[model samples]
Target: MPVSPRIGLVGSQGAYGRWLRRFFEQRMGLQVWGRDPVGDTALSERALLEEVDVLVFCAPIRQTPEVIRHYADIAAGIERGQLWLDITSIKAAPVAAMLSSQAEVVGLHPMSAAPKSATLRGRAMVVCEARLDAWRPWLEAFLAASEADCVRAEAEQHDRVMALVQGMVHASHMVQGAVLRELAPDVGGLDAIRPFASVGYELDMAVMRRMLASNPAIYQDIQFDNPHVAPMLERMSAQLDKLCDLVWRGDNVARDQLREQLLERSRDYAGKQSVAEGSYAFERLGYLLADLREPRFISVFLPLDRPGSLRALLSVFEQRGINLDSIHSSRSADGELLFRIGVSRDGDATALQDAVRAIEAEGIGRVLEASGIA
Candidate 1:
């Protein structure tokens, strides 16, 4: 029977590092050791190099290449059966450095952050095999046990995909936040109008918020360190310029042609069924208009501006089985709260009336204008 491989992970103090260490120790019940240059740890570089059958660099994107290079001699001295792997977001440089070592090298990018749930059951993991001779079976079995969807790609291919996937996407969010700050200079300026935001707008803002809240250095490294990102950003800028020019001209015929071309390209890229399911633009305007016409809009005024009031009002609608098609809330000039809510005409009229009365009776809000009844 083959002996289980002893694993050593570098940078075990970071978030991803800690998560990975716990996963290997607690979940897999593997004999795992860790080494952090800055953190107080028992495992030294020499100890890890001499003992572990597999060494994984779990350092930041910027620091990974240096770590691989620093330990290149130690890795080269390892036995043929041992392996060296890196989990950097960018793969090309680190993979190239790891290939210098005599031991088999494999680059693993877990296409996601550390595991938050019970299992990494269906997450995508990109495996770039630099020199996987003796360790191929071992790595494959480990991935299989973890239930990850392992995608095999060349190092160059992985970096190219990440240049767009991580690089361009992050750049777009940063640019958007900068533009928003330029437009709204005050603190909590854009968020102040969040109550009036549409679902799509809210979703976009949520992604922006999440990204902005993360460590800036990490995003900066992912964007700047990727060699293929500069060209991708240039292409993205050209496309943006083309759209800007078309919009500035306000040419309806040209805009319509552009829209059709874009839709066709999107359908080609994502497949017809996926585009149809995901796009609201594909829906006929007449059908949407008909649905809107069948809804009775009820506008209410709530004096309270505090939190949980909105949830309370929504709870009333939920209990009454009033399906709210649209919700628009804003603060009046005199600092009062105004909410315009839409419910289907097929809904119970008595129940809707009761919901409105309950809010007023509870002194939460009053009915300002109840239209669309006739």
Candidate 2:
């Protein structure tokens, strides 16, 4: 009978570390050991090195390189069949440190947020193999059991991609949050401005809030620790300056030309075959205009003096299979009631048309406007 591999995890108290520890013990049914930086665990450094067949470092991104270097002597002493891995967002530096180990080393990055469930189905895991000749089969088997898509890439390539994917993206959210705080220092200011915000602005604010609420150290590590982030930020700043210059000049023709150029570039980045095949400037504007003309939602304005009017308006939408995404009712100074109903583009067009015609025919309320695109 074959002996089961003993797995050891460092930084077991962090979010990703806890998730990984649970995954290995419960899902893989393996005997696991853990070492937490702040407290004592079942395994000390010496015990981990001596007993475990596989060791995983799950420390913060900035701490990973140093942690690997600190354990170099112990890792070098591990047997040839033992495996070593580090789960870090930026891979190049830590992968280099892990290469010093005599054990088969591989750098792994889980592309999604922390694991919340037992299975990792439909998630992506990036693998940068350093010296995995002896451990590749074991890594593959574990990933297969977890049902994750294992994508192989070089360490430098992974860090380059993460510079944009994590570093720049998080930086944008942090900037937005900072701008909002500067403009609205009062606690209830954001709430007071919600009614005037557009759907797109609301969505952006929600994402910004989520990002700001997460662990600040994570974002700090991503922006400051990634070697490629500074250059990417410089490029973004240059582009922003160009856009600001074009807007400040107020040259409509020049702005339109710039917009077309941006659209072409965006299509290319999105993997369109050719500029002619999917040119947003030439092909998409017409479709976009047509879509705007299609009714996405109906707004009904009724006099406050009239009763049962709100009920009648809702019945029309209910009978038409129109699901309301949002509904806001506000009263004007003159006692007129403004009711806005948001509907998705996926709803029935004929039903919406008939409902609108019926509402207009009955004169229950005047249709103020229709919003969104089909």
Backbone clash pairs for candidate 2 read: none
Please give the RMSD of candidate 1 to the true structure.
Answer: 10.8
Q: Note the Cα lDDT for every prediction shown.
A: 0.78, 0.77
Which residue ranges in model 2 land beyond 4 Å of their true spot?
Answer: 1-3, 185-188, 271-374
lDDT for predicted candidate 1 compared with the true structure? 0.78
Tens-digit lDDT string for candidate 2 (1-374): 11568887878788877888888888888887889877746677877778788889999989999888878766566546788888888899999988877778899888776755565777888989888775667787888887888899999999999999888888888888887888876646787777676545665787788777778888899899988999999988887787777778878876795787665577767775665664555445444333334456677787544678788888888887788666666544343567767676687777777877888787777887765532
TM-score of each: 0.71, 0.70
What's the TM for model 2?
A: 0.70
**lDDT of model 2 at position 98:** 81
RMSD of each: 10.8, 12.6
Worst 10 residues of 1 by lDDT: 282-291
The candidate maximizing TM-score is 1
